[model samples]
Target: MKDAAKLFAYFFAVVIGGALLAPPLFWTAPHFSAFFAKFDFESFFHRALLICALAFLWPLLRSLRLRSFRDLQLDENRHALRDVVAGILLATVPLFVATIALIGTRIFLLKNAVPWNALGAVLAAAIVVP
Candidate 1:
């Protein structure tokens, strides 16, 4: 088979196998939510599954045998810092503005009783997701 076709076959096989096995494999998987007796925003099982899935694909990617980072245009740009800042602003500014407008217009009420644990989860997500 052609390399591309082989890669596609491997990818599909993994995807299908994962889907078929997901239910029974993860039914009793460890998760952060077990501590609280409630669903935590974070999950150990999810992260593990993601890592496993990515690992399964790594061999296929390695077989591609690309030249350099620059050849794939994956090299760092000189304006990377500026571009990152711009991207963050572009994503967050609208959300911030909309939040402000909603609060000002009283469309969305600010909850005075905030849960500390919820704040911790948000902080965790910010750190881990980035």
Candidate 2:
């Protein structure tokens, strides 16, 4: 029960800390670079919040005595690459199917011009952000 309470406190701290930090980061990021200015502020805010949460996570894990993957009950796997590929497929195949269905039904329309330059960045973010 004591550990549970501490866990809850840590969780709240990370969430609230991230929420508080994200706005300032979001506001300041655009001034640092023209590239940052191009994306939506909301997207930037979310990514900033993610970074802040990750920053808080280290302390939480340390406090919980979780210093390694095995401590967290994630033992090393030999088929790591295969598992990753399978996981990605499991996640994306359904989304792709649904997207194709939506387009087929005319609920979603394909853009006439694709932003080729942004595609790699968008894909990288999609893979990394989650």
Candidate 3:
């Protein structure tokens, strides 16, 4: 990879890492010792995805800047076949699993009450992993 590409990759890795790990501050409880607050589901996931998009897009844009669209031909084929196979398999299998999980979650939530799918866990996993 070119230096610029490598730099962008590093940048992308960092921001994504931060987004994956970091959570913003929350309002504290005024009555119950100031450790809990009234933050809702919307605040949590919205902030989380906002953070992730910021973190991810920062580096992705950096990557775009590293090379103009006209000159982005990165094909390192010497040892890429194995890695390519692994990547494809990983992406495909998880997509299938996620599809099934989404279906099951929908049915279960319809019958009872659940919240896992609302987090976009399956989507994040599918996109990030792929």
On lDDT, the leading prediction is 2
Residue lDDT tens for model 2, 56-116: 7787778888898778786579999999999999999999999999999999999999999
TM-score of 1: 0.60
Model 2, TM vs. native: 0.59
Q: How many angstroms is residue 36 displaced in model 3 relative to the true structure, after the best TM-score fit?
A: 7.9
Clashes of each: 0, 0, 0
Scored against the true structure, residue 16 in model 3 reaches a CA lDDT of 60
Error of 2 at 15 (Å): 3.1
Worst 10 residues of 1 by lDDT: 35-44
Indicate the worst ten consecutive residues by lDDT in candidate 3.
27-36
Candidate 1 local accuracy as lDDT? 0.63
Worst 10 residues of 2 by lDDT: 33-42
Best by TM-score: 1
Provide the lDDT at 112 for model 2: 100
**Deviation of model 2 at 5, angstroms:** 1.7
RMSD value for candidate 1: 5.1
Cα lDDT computed for each candidate against the true fold: 0.63, 0.77, 0.57
lDDT of 1 by residue, 43-76 (tens): 4334444555676676665566544455465756
